[model samples]
Target chain A: MQERLGKWLLSWPPLAYLVVFFLLPSLIMMFAAFRYPGDYGGLMPLTSEDPATGKLVLDITLDNWRDYLTLESFVRLVDEPLYIELFIKSLWYATLTTLICIAMGYPLAWLIARSPKKYRDLMLLLVILPFWSNFLIRIYAWMILLGPQSALSKAINLVVTAFGHEPVSLLFTPFAVIVCLVYVHLPFMVLPLYANLEKHDMALLDAAQDLGASAWQRFWKITWPLSLPGVYAGAALVFIPALGMFAVPDIIGGTEGIMIGNLIKQQFLETRDWPFGAVLSIMLTGGVLLMAGLAAAVGRGKQKAKQKHG
Target chain B: MAKRQSWWLWAAAALAYVFLYLPLVIVVVYSFNDSKLNAEWVGFTLDWYHKLFNNREMLVAARNSMVIGVVSALAATFFGALAGIAMHRYKLRLLPFLVLTPIAIPEILMGVSLLIFFVLLNVTLGMTSIILAHVAFCIGFVAIVVRARMQGMDNSLVEAARDLGATPWQAFRLVTLPQIMPGILAGGLMAFTLSIDDFVITFFTAGVGSSTLPLQIYSMIKIAVTPEVNAISTLLMVLTLCLIVLVSKVSPGALRAE
Candidate 1:
């Protein structure tokens, strides 16, 4: 009895707290998505006039849900090429960012993991320390660097003058947005990859080499396969948040780089279309969850197969 | 021959460090620049820092951020420690997964959801609501850290205490709490930093008159990039770095690569 009471005392507070503060809010938001938008930025209720008393009574209806579920919103989303283009563009940006992160992060992670033990923590700190700074300020730093009249641009322009070429515009462009995104998320990719790579058994490589396999062949057959979990984790870490990113694009992305996150922001703040924004939020959430699930499944499958073989 | 090839790896790592630090260095260096705008370099001056000190709104926003960060961290630590201990000590199914939902959900989704929730509840959006929203997300982080710590802890110590005639509360207080205290403290520090640096969720949940530091910096930047912003950014960066160092000191492997 005492143990059960102790368990209840330990568990119930956080469970109740989360249900009220976190889970309840999510449920409300999901429910609001199906209801008609109220005049004041929430769900609306149906109302009808009472016949005998001549008084109006409020009621709930599935009409708002039916309106959205009738294929209109989805069709509208399809017909609107801007939405489609933004979705595709966001995906392309995330993919490119993930690829760049892998290219940059893999080597860096390998170096840190392979570094002398005494200096390893310091090196990792160098990577993580800057992330402590405000993310917006970090993005703003890029703005300063890429500004047309800034020192970096002037130096580049000075070199261009020797060749009689024009100074290039760099700020407020898709290139700038991609650079910032990669800069922001590179650590996420590197950390997990480093965690995986650091534990790798070097003896396997030495054995493969002793068996007369080339370094490239050893990497492909042993190291790459072993690092698959980390690759998936790093990719997921970069890809999901990048897919839903708004602030980076909002700040650095010019007209050409608007994403779905920006669209959702506009709907809530500018358009004041709460239900539509909810729909977009739900879709983005669904996409992110799906990606995370797929990554988890793939990791499990690989582990199971490895267990079978080993 | 292998050493020669490995030099390329070292060079790539060097370049990566340079890539990461270059922007931060620019921000810090330009904070003292006499230039009002970011485009050009003027002679060094402390005018921006002076202006930052005199700015009332910035100071208020900073105070608000600190208060919210501290309060939310405390709240999250208390609740998270309880849940984490329970989950570790008992066979409570389904609760762990539910706790993870807040972290898994996108920040924008969480932000909008909280906004809608507050509006529906007829609660005025202010510091209280913002703190609640922060605590909601921060609990999961703290819970995860504490749970990891508890899972690795030996159970015999608590059993030994109980066998020696200590009550359940006394056993936990004397044995379990001290063992997991570092994890709780580390989780609190992380939660504090996360709250202080948060922008998106705070943006949606914070209505008029309750802007946090990041929100303030963002609005200021939207209007224009001034040297004052750089000074404030440098200050915030220093504060965060100090906290991270303290966190590392508190728990050696807390911020390890994993």
Candidate 2:
């Protein structure tokens, strides 16, 4: 009993903090997703103050709940094609960002993983240092570069103009959104990939070379296969943040570049539709969880097949 | 032959580094440029810096950010160290899930949910709500670091101390804490950085007249392309850079923790 008490004592502060702050808030949001929006802004109160006792009473009725509380938001989420389109576009942008991160991150991770031990820490630090700055500042940096008067824009437009094409505006486009997303998420990809690559054995490569396997062939047969776990890890780290991203799209994403996160933000702050906002948040969370579950299942299946083959 | 085989790999990595650093270099360099366009080299001036220092709203926002960062970091560190120790020792299943979910959920979900929560509880929304939200998220990061530091530690040493009649507090102080102190310190630094740099959650929970630096920067970015924003961004960059160097020096292992 004393030991148990000690355990409880050690664990309760954070456990209680999370229960009050994190878990309860989440359960509230999930519950509120089906409830009616308040006439002013937030959720409609489920309780009412009784004048006789001056106490808050549990006044949610079967009639009220069935008619209004549970109908509007979920129905709107399904009935509106705009929300579905926004959701799919966000997923697309996130998936594209993950792919770009992989393409760019692979070479950097490999180089650092193969670098001399004395310089490895410095290289890794260099990769992470840029990420530590307020990410808005980083996005702002992209804004300056992609703006109309910047050299990169001028150069690209110069080529287009020479070819008898109109000058292309870059900022506030989906292109700008994707670039910022890749920039923000690249460090996440590089770190995990480096960790996995660092542990790879060189003997297999040397032996493969001795057998007259070309570098490309050797990489495809050994290094690439060995790095799948890291790639998956990196992909996951990139995708979730990218999927839920709003700030990138909000600042750089123009009329055409808005995503589901933008809509969710609008519902809460601009539109004052808390129920719809809650609904959007639940959908995004549920979709991510569903994808994660599917990925885990596939991973398990792969492991089982490998075990059987071996 | 060795050189010939690896040039392309080296080239790709070099390009990636340039891509990573060049935009930031432009931002820093332009802060010194004396042009409204923020594109051309038209001599240098400290005009924006002067303007930023005089901006009362910017000063208040910076002060708010500093206060929130320190308090939330302290609360998060204390709670996180406990969570970390308990998790490592007790194999607490529920704690890990609670710790990790905040890290995994999108910032917007957490933002809206907490906003709803504060409204429901009639908690006055401002610095207190922002700090509560920050600590809630930062505990996860600090806990992860502390847990990482606890891994590979000499548990037997603590057990031996206990066997030699040391009290739980004494065993912890002498054997366990010193082992994990670096982790705890590093975790605290990380929590501070995360809190100060957070924008999305702060946006939702910050009531009227209570703006943090990132929220300030966001509003500025949305409205105007002022060099004042550049000046503040440069200052923020330098501060975060210092913190990174400090974290590396204090606990080099923590750099490798994540």
Candidate 3:
């Protein structure tokens, strides 16, 4: 009995802490998503003002919920071509960033995994060390590098001038935003891929070679299949956060590269429309969750197939 | 174990490292640049560093961040260690997911939700609220690190203590506690760095007259990229690097465990 009580005591602190701070806040946001916006910023009463008190009384209604659930927001999103364009633009940027990260990260992860044991830790540290700095400062560094007056842009301009073309202004462009996003999330891709590749058995490849399989065949039939999970994990890591990223776009994207995250920020801080912001928040959360669920399902399916084959 | 040396792969890795370090090098180098504007290559000087020290708002923001980081790290470590041990020792179905939700969710969502939560609760947003928010997210990180450490520990040692008539509390205090001390310290250090570096959540939850270093840096950068901002960024980066080094030295396995 005492031991059981002690176990409960040990578990309850974090559980309660999370409930009060983390879970409760998320639940509140979910509830707020279903309520009407007040005149200024916060949620409003569902009913009209009381005549005796001349004050708005607190009540529950699905009016706010219905506004979103009935596709009102979706219609608004459709009606506004800018929002749809931004959504597609954000997806395009995120997809390009993920692709670039994979191109750069896969080889790096492989090299690190294949490196001698003593140097492995140092290599991994190098990958993570840049992330120690403030994210804003890192993006600022990119701004300096890509600025028109900076040496890099000047040098590029020289080449373009010699070629009878216009000077390159890289700052405040979608290309700049994509570059910084890839830089910011490259480590996220590398870490998971490294973790996955480090434990892979090379003997399987040797066995395949001994069985008269070509190198490409061995990789296709063995290595690629094995690394799919890591690829999916890395993709998810890079994709989800990249989709909702605001700071990079806000700093470097200018008006051309504004994403849904910036729109959500505008609603909450700029427009002070908490209900609309809550609606966008719910949509983002739902989308992220759905993507994660799909990835997990695919991963599980691959796992089962591998098990059956083995 | 001799394998073919892939020069192309090594070159690619080298280039990747360059990409990662280029911006960091720029920040550090520009901190000493004599020019106020970041455009020109002026002679080297320490004026920015000097200004960084004399700036009142910057110092106060740094102090606020330090206080919040330390307090939240300590609080998160305590709760995280308890929960980590509990999860390792007990079989709870939903506990792991609960811990992971904060980490997996987007920071904007967490920030906005917490802001709403504080408003609904009628709690003033300031150092206390920021610390609470930090602790809420930091707990998951600490829990993950500490739990990874505990997973590799010998279960028989705790069981033997119990068999020798040690009370549950005593077993935890004398046996299990000492074993996971390094993990707790590592987790605490990580939490501290994370709190100091956090911006989005802190941006939303920070009330009037409560600017942290990241907030100060953001405002400064938004206006212009001055050498003073570079100085502060260099300082913050050095501080985080030192803490990470300390964490690695304290628990070499902690990084790999994550």
Writing each residue's lDDT as its tens digit, candidate 2 over B1-258 gives: 122338888999999999899989988888988988868789899998999999999999999999999999999999999998888889788898998888876788899999999989999999999999999999988888898888869789999999999988788899999998988999999999999999999988999878999999999999977788889999999999888778877777686676
TM-score of each: 0.93, 0.97, 0.94
Better of 1 and 2 by lDDT: 2
Pairs that collide in candidate 1 are none
Q: After superposition, how far is residue B30 of candidate 3 from its true place, in Å?
A: 1.3
Give the per-residue Cα lDDT of candidate 3 at B73.
Answer: 96
DockQ, all candidates in order:
0.65, 0.77, 0.74
Q: Which candidate number maximizes DockQ?
A: 2
Sort candidate 3 into its docking category: medium
Q: Which residue window of length 10 is worst by lDDT in model 1 chain B? A: B1-10
lDDT of each: 0.85, 0.90, 0.85
Instruction: Encode model 3's per-residue lDDT on B1-258: one tens digit a residue.
Output: 547747888899999999999888988898888997777778999999999899999999999999999999999999888888788878886667777788887788999899988987779999999999999989888888899889888989999999999988899899988999999999999989999999988988999878999999889888876889889989988898999899999988676555
Expressed as tens digits, the lDDT of each residue in A1-310 for candidate 1 is 9988998899899999988888888887776666666677645544657899889775545654464333444455668887778777888998899999999999999888877788888998889887778998898899888888687778878998889887777788898989999999999899999989999998898889999999789979998899989999999989988888888888888787777899888877777777777777777877788889989999999999999999
